[model samples]
Target: EYRLTNPPKPPATVEVMDGENRKHTLQVQVLGAEETWHTPSLLLASVGSSGGKVVFSQIRTLDPTEDVKQYGSTLNRNKICDIAFYQKVHLEVDPGQYESEETKFQALQKSDKARLEILQDLLSSHLGLSVAEKQGPLPAYTPGYFLGRHELKLDFLSALQPRLKADNILKLNLLSLQFCGKGVEPSKPTASLMPVFLHACPQRFSTVEYFENLHSEHIGRLLIFSEVMTSSMEGLDGAVLHHGLAVVACQQISGAGRSGNAWLSPEGCGMFSLQLHIRSDSYLGHHVPFLQHVVSLAVVLAICSQAGHEDVDLHLKWPNDIYVGDCIKVGGLVVKTIVDNTMTVCNIGVGMNLDNNVPTTCINALLRELKLAPLSLEKFLALVFTKLEKLLVTLEKGSSGVDQVRQLYYKYWLHSNCEVTVIGPQGSKQEVTILGIDDFGFLQVLAKDGCAFSVHPDGNSFDMLRGLIAPKVK
Candidate 1:
């Protein structure tokens, strides 16, 4: 094994040219607690990382093989499994393969390992320069925590894993490292220590208590946080938020989804629910359905503005979805309204792929691909709040305002004029062309025979001919 200490600055890029002149460039970075290896070459299968050291790693095949079963037993004690638990480090980065975890995971499935010689050369070339760059004393750099393939050792995580697993978050920060820490205190935002979603408010405050002045407003009642729990919304609902509340959570144990489906509570994704009690005669209660559209639009606008581009191709899937570009379901909203006393409580939950956690949906990665810097999570939240306030005011105008909101949403509708195959409950498939969305938000789809029908959110679903549905990573 090659031991190289005191490496140069993080994300040090090095290219290896061997006897055959086969060249490969490796970008080395020191992660907080995630060990990741990525490359485009078939020769270098993978390299291992542990104790803050890079070792010879056997590539992890996406398809479950015999080794997967063995990973839990004898193989767990083997060298491959040993490398599974490593320190903070990143071996390679291909920003081009950026997308949601699901899309990239599909690419991983077809990957084949490189020859041992290629991987060895790739390591020796990069590591040799890493050592050469630092000719001084070694530093006491160590990780506070470590993660194994099947096991993890962390005081705070043990108490939270059960609940996270219950919500189908099998892999926390599966792609990137958001939701990778506890949350920010009622203080300024730190990249690794703060809650990116609501770091700062429109008030310019950078802490939990920062949303204080807004506490006087109907939108800002209480911003609750949990060291371990199910969800931010659930937490608020549990407390019976009478004054209205926006509960933010770093990790969600059990998440709710549409049609009684369980939503995945990922650590890094922005997961929160805003509950506002809209009275029967209130402006918002009369337009509850349109409120969902406004929230979704608000999130899209927030992200688009952050990208410094209004033409980022973000779209609404009617009801509540924020689709980025053409392939990724970046984030979405789940609106559940209830009658509490004589008021209608609108529980508007918003989520998104924020950072490295959801690479595909990560706003930063998307911007990076477009050659732009990422907008800080704190600023992003502040922008969202600002836009949301305006949207709510427009929706409260009754009919005309509602029509304007619909038009805005329609301008970004993802399925309009697209070919889609609707699959009925009986597994029957019929191809149709989406004309547009109805005034009520249901999809207006046209069949080949020229029959137009309104498709509501239900058991029957249509597959858009535009994007591919890759199987999700476990």
Candidate 2:
């Protein structure tokens, strides 16, 4: 029932309101006479209202296809995706929306008007707005900004330091002090803050600033460095018991990717790893495989929160790639979970192109194309953590939670009813239409002859641009 073949077409009618508060109903119709699975169609209408005649002009808005009517039907799917990308970039400006430079400026001003306010509201509900202040600042260890040692309590640091040192934790200091309520207004709240250790330095964004903006307990410790080896998940095998700990790097010398491909992680990329403790007996633990899906959705929603979703053309490609428009990849997610007795220790790693453009593209570059302001790595991380916290709660709600996430995943993903060339077990190629995810989170595809099969993300390489899904070379 959750699988999708041919999704129902767009609605038949749309209601439009005139300046005088009068409502007019217009019939919606696809532009092209002939429609295919990947056909590009524009829904436009011309109707009269009391104020004036409302004629919906034809514009180059993107649809999920090659526009077979305009271009001949023999184009490949990847070519279609590339064409759609270029068309969307050079879309005709709607006179009503951007008549003049002043009007366009006004529209940009009104965009994301309540984003910060919304973030503050979530912070108040999740982390308390106010709490008792810590007794005093701890001794300054490595001097720069607000000294990292100044935040540590003597008794707690003495104990945690030995354990951290024995574990070979490098370039990180241990702290057991409560989170200082620095950003928000002062108030009296009964709840006291929990104390934990985090990595802070002048090398990147202030560690103190990170916790001040973050409002979730899921990210307990933060470790950020100028560079790291292999991946963020490297040298973290023994840290599973330290739940909610995260490691970040400004640049990765050798970043890992799905199926052992190398991820180009130069400077300006947002790369990090988070360790979480989930109970095996719990609802979320039973669906460990779905963690990748959850993280992927969280990444998309976090960026979408910055500017309105309509302004940005970001979307999820089949398994875990974060694609912009239909061609360029902007970010990705990787999940590694270990079941130790009754505890399922999960490590979620994420790499996003926040401001970097060296590889393919980044989130800010995409925003730039839309004439929007760039997002800071700090703000992006805060939003991502907030979203991940909210989604994890939803995932804990049982079957209904699964259905909600599934619906959202389908909505934000790029491959619905798309036909791709799949290489089977014996290396024979066959074209198949993408249905949806099966119950186990694998991609379910339907063949032309009514034969259905599931494609595992690990075993297959999804080349969306080429419209090819081939077996990964072991």
lDDT of 1 at 412: 77
TM-score of every model versus the real structure: 0.50, 0.58
Q: Highest TM-score, which number? A: 2
Cα lDDT for residue 472, model 2? 81
Task: Please give, for residues 270-355, the per-residue lDDT of candidate 2 as tens digits.
Answer: 88777878888877777677778878888888878664546687898878888887888888887777787798888787899899
**In angstroms, how far off is 377's CA in candidate 1?**
3.2
Q: Each prediction's Cα lDDT score? A: 0.51, 0.62
Write model 1 residue lDDT over 71-113, tens digit each, in one string: 5555433334323222322234332355467776556443412
Error of 1 at 228 (Å): 4.1
Listed per candidate, the RMSD to the true structure in angstroms reads 17.1, 21.0
Error of model 2, residue 195, in angstroms = 21
* Positional deviation of residue 80's Cα in model 2 after best superposition, in angstroms: 51
